[model samples]
Target: MSWQMADIWENIAQAIPDKPAIVDGDKRYSWAEYEDRAARVAQVYTDHGLKPGAKLAIYSYNSAEYMEAQFGAFKARICPVNVNYRYLEAELTHVINNSDSEALVYQAQFAPRVAAIREQLEHVKLFLEIADGSGEHLDGAVDYETALQAASPMPVIERSDDDLYMLYTGGTTGMPKGVMYDHKTFSSALFTKGFEMREMTLPEGAAGFGPLTQALHAADAATRSIPACPIMHGTGMWIGAMIPHALGGCVVLFDNSHFDPAALWKLTQDEKVTDLTIVGDVFAKPMLAALDDAQAAGKPFDLSSLQMMGSSGVMWSAEVKKGLLEHIEMVIIDSMGSTEGSMGASVTTRETTESDKTASFDMAETTRILTEDGKPVAPGSGDIGLICNGGMVPLGYYKDEKKSAETFRTFDGVRYSIPGDYATVEADGSVTLLGRGSICINSGGEKIFPEEVEEVLKTHDSVYDCLVVGVPDDRFGEKITAVLSVSKGTQFDEGALNDHVRANLAAYKTPRAFITVKDVPRAANGKAGYKDAKEIALNALNLEVA
Candidate 1:
């Protein structure tokens, strides 16, 4: 039988009708109740003239309504676009216009931003605003809950396996481009092996079939997953939230807006969350600090219910990854993925050794690494370009044939999605992600990438966060500069930061100059906005373009 993404939910609702499906602080929804709410949301969409395959944009943070919108979109057969909550007016307008989104559902917190871009969003016909119990409303938007209440709770549409359910990639390099995925792609790429591998134990009869249904049921019964990341990025949308739901697990929403280690720990302990997905060092560092503070107080937090821990979004350093495992005493699965891919590019397993944990390669069999000349390279080859496959690789970038043709290519009669990532292929065939190739810096005669330097800089105790980039120079052609957000109470001295990097990295790779700031510029997904960072770096250095 063919796989249907919507069917995964149906199976869980039937098998575990009363099981907890989602939890947001004081609120909790059972599987049946969640489905009913999703059905009503679907009815609302249909009643508002959104047909199957129509584009609907969700511009909210992690919430019950966010999940409802996803399931509701599937039920209504509308293609849901997860808009980044942190996007400014220009960024938000670009996606809205590019995706040709017909309707937008957003929280009241972002009303001002929406109001700013509403005039520019030519394609958006309906604007749905979610109130934060403050009774505040955006001028030209309808109430979210009121619309749902007025709409019928009927499942108005049925989606086929080939119907596009997700638009995974948001084109940050240029304009946002949609990477369309169907129900079959979700079941095959995400459900089959991805969720199955995360389970501690499998049921007797649940071994062979797509483990998604059974996992959702078991997760709903046993585990509660805390998704700290926003729902716009694939890590936050698919791996962090949806997959947990596919397992019938409760999702704990961390809606603090900014990263607060103490608040996160308090939420986790209070919610009794069993599983947690850490994005990278930015997230993990604060969490570790909070844990340390708790330990120092002689009241070691009861994180006993925490069973499984994993890291995704950005790559975590070996030291940070080790620190987390040692502290938690649980297996840590570090993974690498891209927006063009269906989220699960590669993942480390429990049995993977410490040495293997540090080295980033262990990709699935379907994943491949090839050189610029299109020849495959052997494992342990220093740094080879990577192209991942299997699951729902995007059809093409929406509306940009030139980029679509270049990125989505056909080799050996099979189409492969290569989003310009470089990695090291280990002896055992695992892949270690280096960084994006497009942003790689060539300084003096050395090939330096910002990610490599940023990783080293993050290890510094005084540095809270930093972004590294290459600036045009007369002597070296391009010189490396580091812009940093230092820890509170720490001094921002360029000489001291230079010495720190010199101790860890090659002299040529270290940042030639440092600019201290309160925060590093980043996109909604915690990714460095290199262009923005470069602009800041150049202005600080008083460097002129040649």
Candidate 2:
């Protein structure tokens, strides 16, 4: 109960001072240096008059600095709030104001947006800027490196179990809210996941971490994870960075400004990465294409070192996993979770590929499928219910008691985090994940999950990515629409795609209208952004859906 993230990490740094802690392109930081930098960042927090339980938002891309500030916030007992890098002025302002953040650490490239909304953010007292060579600077913002150089490292202090760790999630369905977790439960679950990833358990307590990490490193079994997505996302921060860091592994970040599959593959090969964190098929498809292209060019990446690739927050199609397996023999892990809590995960390998479906998962004992009336859904019954995670649930959403009570509630005297995700329990106690109930479309009195329809559409040979949304219709009350980004060098046939959907799903579930876009909107966390799709569909529904 006494184990703290920063405290354990400081001891790890003392034990493995010279070991690589983070790798980004040509630069690397050792464990001692990582700790020192984070401490200096904490100094900045202290200097800004931020006290215990104070909140600060991090607005930056994936960099070593992003993580240093997070760890620093932990040491200083400040709540680190993650701001999506893709958010516009309105969305950014809502997150900062909603979270009650007093300080901001932003990348220089995003200075314009910050400066634009800086005046509106009256609660924010400090702005710490990280420079990119882009020469984008903001007035009244403290330069990151300059501050670290000017300030002495803030010494470590005892931290409380109730200290906060906040992750913002809404994923385009609505405005993002900060999901709150106490340090005690969050870090405990994180360490459990990290050790489970290695097929081991924690030795005992904080005292055993130094020896365990040293032995693992000596045995050449240190975890090296690549957070292929933006670190602002929970998947990137929790699974990719914090978990691996807690286990004393070096986190390898992509050096590319944009998502380049070739760059990611080369980074994994160069770093001998043991695991990677991605957001389902959205990332897997492009990465698989890169492997094919690179191999055809007579320069296949050396992916023999990669042991596992994990995806969450979106669909990871079965075919995509098979395609990746064709190139490298690695485990494909699909995790189902949101900022609220982890529901379940499924692992697919070459041998198990035939039996794996895109959305099926094996649940932990703490997770249960419950009906609206507080009864557990019987296995083998075709009943759908909210997938509730029972143990170690979030305290609640920050600053929204109504939402908190609705999301994190007590069902039959046990607290659970049920974020409106509906699913059914199989006879074997596994789950068939339908989708989020909030986004489900009701057409002609029949409910249809968009993810179920989207999965069928993505199976088309011409489709690259697709999002399904319900649009207003006079007859059906709501019409199903498809927003697609076609595959490269291919043309889309709405009729053929509709037929494909009908083949796999019910006729009513098939999209009533089809529209093409250059890109399907997704949150920074790689989850579907349905708002844009609905607007696009409704604007042209009358002309197209007849």
| Top candidate, metric TM-score | 2
- Put down candidate 2 lDDT per residue, 1-546, tens digits, no spaces: 356778778878988899999997776899999999999999989998999889999988899989899989989999999998888999999999999999999999999999999889968998999988879989988999999989999988988877888898865457898888888788887678667766888755556677778987999888899999888888988888888887889999875357888889988998899999999888899999999999899999999999999888889999999999999998888988887888889989999999988788999668989998779999998888899997659999888899899988788799999899999899998998899988999999999999988888888889999999988788998888899999998888878887788889889999888899989987656688787777777776543433
Off by over 4 Å in 2: 489-491, 542-546
TM-score of each: 0.90, 0.96
lDDT by residue (101-215, candidate 1, tens digit) is: 8899888888888887788998888888888774567886888899888877865344577877656465447656777666676556665454566653422222233354555
- How many clashing pairs per prediction, in order? 13, 0
Model 1: residues with Cα > 4 Å off, grouped in runs = 168-172, 199-221, 342-359, 487-506
Superposed by TM-score, candidate 2 places the C-alpha of residue 235 at a distance from the truth, in angstroms, of 0.3
Model 1: residue 436 alpha-carbon error in angstroms: 0.5
- Using lDDT as the measure, which candidate wins? 2
Model 2 residue 8 lDDT? 76
